[model samples]
Target: MMQFCYDDLDQWCHHCVHFVFVDEGLIAFSSFVLHLCAIKA
Candidate 1:
């Protein structure tokens, strides 16, 4: 997983319109998608 700066997360949240910080650390959507793709492959 990648580490994002606060500003990067802020920008994403602004553009995403609906975002929440979950305690489980499952917030990195792009990485999560890539991980899933890798798993499928």
Candidate 2:
């Protein structure tokens, strides 16, 4: 039971990290697109 709990916690942590990484990538892409638009304008 303890091992199962630890595994669950590890999986949750991995998911959280993956989400944050994806979120950061999206924000960076958005900023890059805006920068391009500003330059075009």
Off by over 4 Å in 1: 1-27
Candidate 1 per-residue lDDT, tens place, 1-41, comes to: 22342346444443431233443464576455445445655
Candidate 2, backbone clash total: 0
Q: Tens digits of per-residue lDDT for model 2 on 1-41?
A: 22442355343343322332356656665455445445655
TM-score for candidate 2: 0.39
The models' CA-based lDDT, in order, is 0.43, 0.44
Worst 10 residues of 2 by lDDT: 12-21
Alpha carbon lDDT at 17, candidate 1: 18
Q: Candidate 2, residue 14: CA error in Å?
A: 36
- Per-model clash counts, in order, read 0, 0
Location of the lowest summed lDDT over 10 successive residues in candidate 1: 14-23
